[model samples]
Target: MTTEIHVTTLGHWSNSSAGPTTSFHLAADDAEVMLDVGVDPVGRLQAAGLSPTDVTHVYVSHLHSDHVGGFANFVFTRSLLNRAGDVPLLKLTIVGHPSVLAGLKELLRVQYPEREFDLAWVECGEEPVALGGQLTMRLVPTDHPVPCYGVVVETGRARIGFTADTGPVPSHQHDFAGCDVLIGEAFGLRGDVGESIHRRGHMTAEDLGELVAATRPKFVVPFHFGQEYADADKRAELLSACGAAEVTTVDPVDAKPVIIGG
Candidate 1:
């Protein structure tokens, strides 16, 4: 089983680059899975050379537009691209917290009132959903203002934990314990953050550092940046803080897809 993680970033700490916001393109050799459909997503994913026909699943992090805003376009694109004879349109599943169904669904219907495809709305709760091949995923509740979740993608060889939009509660991260790759959001200035910031659920670099120590991930990829920082130094600290453990930096926009386990 092989998995490819292509990250076409839109907006980051400072810039949006060529992509939309923070959507991810996770492809498992035979199947395609998209995480989050943030604003301008189809354009971004297409820009990355991937078409809607290739995507089979979409797991959203939250109700934020930047996360699930492109649901309609994704469906529309699939409708246009996968109309080959004898083959059904790609099956699309949209997963998200149950609390966000009204908002995300309303947006979807608004864009495509004629809902015209094989789509299923799975309110991601406790069941382990199979993502084809050797990949399986589970969405866990994270500490955010509204209902939000971080994804845990596991393969036979390794496991990857992605903290979408979370605060500092670390309680939700326990499921990620001992993962091979931990992708955490680093979205704030350390000393500069006001007292009210941490309470908002977006993890600061410091909070992520603490999480890395507690969770004991072999590798840490810090994502989601703050507007004030230009360098990756803040995210780099996860290396020193973790005592010689390997650390890789994922810029808001990276050209090549990252493969966790070869």
Candidate 2:
């Protein structure tokens, strides 16, 4: 009865990186979900061998540009493709906090006033949202300057947790507990500088390590790193901190699918 969930980090680096921001693609039980749109999500999705038309749902964690900058493009591209007869216009569901959804809708209206797309908007809250088939998702509030949320997606046999972006919040330990795979943010290394970032609503490697120890997910994937941390040595240092918690740590590779479960 084990379910295999395939997760691909479409974009792992933070805004500082001259690359894609933060986005993840999760394929489970016939559900194709994107954790965040980030910038150029459509391009990244194509590079990962996934067609935009195949995506069933997109979950936005917050309103940060880095996390949702590409949403307009995604919608516009889909509409354009349908108009070109390249694909049929399918209804796409977008889930996010009410505020985030409102803002994104306005953004689309402002960006493309003439185009109308097939999109269903769902506001995420404490209730578990049914995502077709046996898949369901629950949203948890995170500690950030702006309103943000983390998500836990359940696929019958496995639960996948994603900490979109946030500072150290103790409640997360319980929120993400028992997840088969937990994708947490480790924005920086442990040090004085890291402490500053932590206070600004971002987790450092040490913070993520502590969470891993407490939540004890079967597998932990760390991401949302600054460009400097992308260096091999710095990346190793961050992984070591998480490994110290005696849990398996997986480094997210852009566009590479990491299979979770048996």
Candidate 3:
């Protein structure tokens, strides 16, 4: 059996006409994982030719609305589908920091008090968590105003890293080192927005470039910017910053899967 991992960015912008927010769908062998349940995730998944029921795991980086606002909607949609006999209820495992999980649980309870879900919770810890088959994930703490975590997913044949929502955290270089693909946040251009970007706990293109330089990932996918950066010239500028670090930048706006292995 050949091992292949496909990473697709369902939503890439922080805020703008191009947003549902920051979300990604990763499929490998026996696992289908969602990096974040950004707003309108169900619609985004469907737009990407996928369904919420197909997801086996969801990893929440933080409790921010942009990252977790659609979580209840996803769960509710799945439950409704199962109730309507459109699909069978599958146990969905949610991986996140304890606080994040708690917040999600409360959100679900408040949003759907009349329903029950086949859900499992896993708290992010220092140890890597296996996601069945040959896939395993390690959640590393990231620098953010609120509790947030970056994730590294390893298949037998490939390793993918996600920086989540963060500022320039030097320690993350060691955690994301040797990744085949690194999906990083490029919220803006360095100095273009001054210290506001860092103050918000988000990285600029230059910050992401520094990370790419340190990690040396084979491919760096930049996302989580506004619509302004979606323009061809601005996009190129963003790519130039990261690419100058000697790493290839895969534009997440293309909505194409970045395939690894096989």
Candidate 4:
């Protein structure tokens, strides 16, 4: 069987960025998954030519505002579409850490007391789990100030690794070995304060470069760029340090989805 992974970058910045926040759309055949539903994810989804209802599974790496702030919006929008009586409510499966899911439920309950949305929440751990009937997913703990995880998605032929938002978790490299594409964050450029960056639970350009060098993914897609490193040169400098043969930086110039097959 041939499996295809289609990854679209909806937004590529941390919460602080003036632009849309970081989010990714990963799809394999008929299964559509959202990597992280950042603030205004619905708008970002539309911008990327995707509908909110098209998302079947959502895998959140952490509970930061940039990652889950738009959870209610996504649910509400999808609910509205269902209420219009034009289509059935799309079943949304939310996967996240136990505590994160708990907090999310409370947040939703508090915000929309009168209305209930059609969705299911799955609290995930470090164990590998099967998703969408074909993809295999595993969450590995990452080096962040708060509890966070790096997601690994694999099919029979290819694997995609997402660092989410982390400083450095060298042991996690083992989980990402030989991935077809590795999406890592570059929160700051080389001259930034290493301690400060790590303290904020983010990675500097050098940090991501080191990670790519260690993991050796076939392709590296750097996103979640800090304001100072928004320029392509800054991103290029980071990739140069990675010493990888193929590195891709997604920007306005090239907003097309990256396709990987297995």
What's the CA RMSD for each of the models?
3.3, 2.1, 1.8, 2.4
Better of 2 and 4 by lDDT: 2
lDDT of 2 by residue, 87-129 (tens): 5666889998898899889989999898887789988787888
> Runs in model 4 with CA error above 4 Å?
1-3, 85-87, 247-253
Per-residue lDDT tens digits for candidate 3, residues 78-189, read 7676576655667899998788899999999999998888899987775788867887888888878998999999888888999999888889889999999999988878
- lDDT per model vs. reference: 0.66, 0.84, 0.86, 0.76
List TM-score per model, in order: 0.82, 0.93, 0.94, 0.90
lDDT of 1 by residue, 177-199 (tens): 87776767776646656446668
Worst 10 residues of 2 by lDDT: 79-88
Residue 65 miss distance in model 2 (angstroms)? 0.6
Task: Please give the range of 10 consecutive residues that has the lowest summed lDDT in model 3.
Answer: 80-89
